[model samples]
Target: MTDATALVQHLNSDFSAGHDAVPARVNGTASPAIEQALAHPDLAEPIAAALAYAVVRARGAVRVAELGTCPADRVRPLRRAVERIATERAKAEAVCGPLRRPAQRASHRLGRSLKQTPARAVLPAAHRQTLVTACAELGLHADAFSVPNQRNGAWAQSRGLFGSVPSEAVRELAARDDTEFVAALLHDARMAEDERLGHHLIVERWNRLSATALAWGPYAIANAERRAVSRPLHARRDVLDALEDAYEDLAVLTCRAGEAKYRAFRLTCQVRELTVTGKRASVAAAAHRRAHELLQVSHPEELAEIAEAVRAHQVDCPFRADGCPDCQRVVLKGLSGQCQEAPGSRPEPTSPPQPTDASGPGVTYASFGAEERYAVLNDIPGGARVVVSDAAIGEDSALCGYGWAAEDGTTGHGDSMASTSGEAEIIGVCAAALTALTTHANDEFLVLCDSRQAVDAVQEVEEHGDVTRAQEAVLFPEAGELLTRLLPYAHRITVRWLKGHIGHDLNEAAEALAGLALRQARGRIAERTAHRARARTTSRIATQYLPRRSMPHAA
Candidate 1:
């Protein structure tokens, strides 16, 4: 049998069993037993086995369609197969978790192989003729030649990394006609060549354009579902060498991206210091030590370039380049200076403590034994204050709350009925700092917190300027979003460490608020859980006791 016929036969045979088990529907409705079994892995074996067969059928169709040797009419059956598989996977996600990734992988393999195929096999007649004529004029063989295979492959790889073509790029392509699509792609190809850039550099520029026709848009040649190519891995030596090259490229790029991000964040801190305080920011000896440890760099010289850039910006004073040349000279001279302080020796509170909100009726704050004096440096300028914040989680990992107290007797706290302690900790600190920053935008603020993880998360945001990095590190996701919102006001913010329950006044007060918040949150959670249980009991009783026709309608 031919490729299409063989694919149809495989799909038919594989899915022949349980033909009536799931009705063909796009509504994503399914039987409760099947749904429950799919979601719960202990009950997944039966459904997983059934899905394995469907996966095989769908993947095979995609593969044969991609090979380019198949007839054009075969596209119809292949499209239908893809749709059916997608529908099935959509309905199964209640149990299957994520099946689309496997389907996407199959498509990627197809797109990557298309580049090595002849243009006549991959492109339609008009476009193929255009390419053929152009090739003849350029003194290249029409029938046997590939179309810029290296850049095309690189674009394909970038698409695979990004997962899909961006929507804006797709919308731009939608405005263009099919012939223009090919013309625009060729135009970009010529531009890439004229620049004399390597394949990866050209591809990176194309990817960054976001509006370029060569972008993997719906009608673009580099479309992940259409024309593309990859080298065959059957040649062991070539494949191995290619793998090594790719690994090296990826590793170098990852390192550079991280290093650049770190340097950018540090420079931002320095700029904030100069702009806000009219003097250099004091660096904590330990904070720098921690940063170096995380970066895994032995020499400080790796950081010197970005540090110099920050100093240059301060000196050049682009915002006031001509008017304050003398001011710039003084600032540049001071940029080389640092006032290092020993760890945990932050400035002491200048203002007296305000009384705690002890009369709140719902929950009582937990008091840590007796208040004791902790040594704090008295070096901070008159008005600057540290906000000591902390998060508390209940035993069942359900209830969470965070609280903060500024050295000037300004205190605030918030609570949530759900989340882990780590999540709660970061949220508490970030949420507290966000409120404080909004209230005091012009004042310098330091966030003192007890959770090392939470402090590190804030540090990550400071060093990388990516709050979502915390969520990517599997810290709290909500905390990441909150931190992202706080970025605009970051110039005035600093986060530092505080030892928990050590009898420092603001730290103790913040702890009390955190504990109280946790208590209140747990009570709220308990009420909700009880309410849900009661509702479920009522539902079961009504279902079992009442006649089907007489059962009360659900609101």
Candidate 2:
């Protein structure tokens, strides 16, 4: 806020489209706060941008046509007006070397931000034109990464899609993954509204930052390459932190977008409120309850659309009561049509199996099996996954070469590479509770896991056990041969075990993030990932749960 020091002065006053807006009624007035912020320098622009993004989003394409009373036209006022701040910052830096631009340049930067650099625009409804321009600009500037043939609809729904939230649809403000939000908001809205919102939803919820954004946003490849080159854990974490921060404003923009959708479409209604933890099961129940309430509405255009969408995604037209909870979102949507029943997969026959390990001396491994519904966060597969279809294999980045699993699994042999790390596929992963030493040298290394087996070859203590163990390339195998070589030039190195999803917070977050990144990379945007984050509510009220069925668990 180079212009206003403390707060935004006249947020709603900037637009003169002649609409009746009772700002005092909808968004509470903060004149005193605005006046106070006017005196501060850093707060105005971001706030203004956030406000502007909210407006442009409210005004969707087909602006007044589809918007009707929605006033989707307002979505562009500020986006059309704001200056290209990111680019001006770049040019200013070219001359000033790290110092911010002169006040005049910044004013021009914020005055018409979208016009100058359309790629940085926050309005999802304007992504098509902006993305084409962005592609052209990147081609001229960074030919290596320019998106040439990419089309719009990554934001707006394409043909045959009912609808999805625009890239600007905000779920959480101050979210860690904001880059994808920006990418969708500024570039993909032009996507035919038919493609629906699934792709953007998945990515926006999961991957806010990407290697592409880092490489292209006001930085050079040298900086992007450094992301791969850094070894110190702190350095890597800092880089991630900076990328997450780069698009914090995107969340604010999306918040406005979600509000806009809720207002204009009126697609959802609350029939009842339920008290529950922040989990998929809880959220799904909430969605179901909302859907049921909307069904009773006299005039529910949005609810009808959702009903059709739900039927199209469900495992069966009406979900079976006794079935696996782990179901695919798309399949569930397909099955959720005009049925009036509890949602779940169709029941299948199960054959009895032998049991032994259950009575073993002790549990040797973490035992949470992979559950498809709760595939992420849980160390082991959840029961939900048991009912999932194998055909729904997601094009996740972890399945690609970018995730830690892929990196760990890489192996080199006689001019060939292979994936062999059993560690990557281990279920119920837990950490070893021990740390491995790191080195200074940035050379890549390998893990020869077979040597650990050699340690078990001889358990009894012997005088020459240590010497004999070192001779063969088996017991303490890799360590014995490479110990001396690693001591001299290494700066930082650490041997870490990825325990099966044994409830470690960081590992869970990473796995969740990786799944999200995969969806985004695969270009599926509407897959919303519901995580256990605290909700944003001005008031905290609790609810009591009542059973819908009389003998809910009776045989």
- Number of the predicted model whose TM-score against the real structure is largest: 1
lDDT of each: 0.44, 0.27
The segments of candidate 2 whose C-alpha lies over 4 angstroms from its true place after superposition are 1-184, 188-257, 260-555
The stretch of ten residues in a row with the least summed lDDT in candidate 1 is 111-120
**TM-scores for every predicted model:** 0.29, 0.19
Q: What is the per-residue lDDT of model 1 for residues 286-346, given as tens digits with 9 covering 90 to 100? A: 2223323332243244234324544555555664544332232233233323312211225
In terms of lDDT, model 2 sits at 0.27
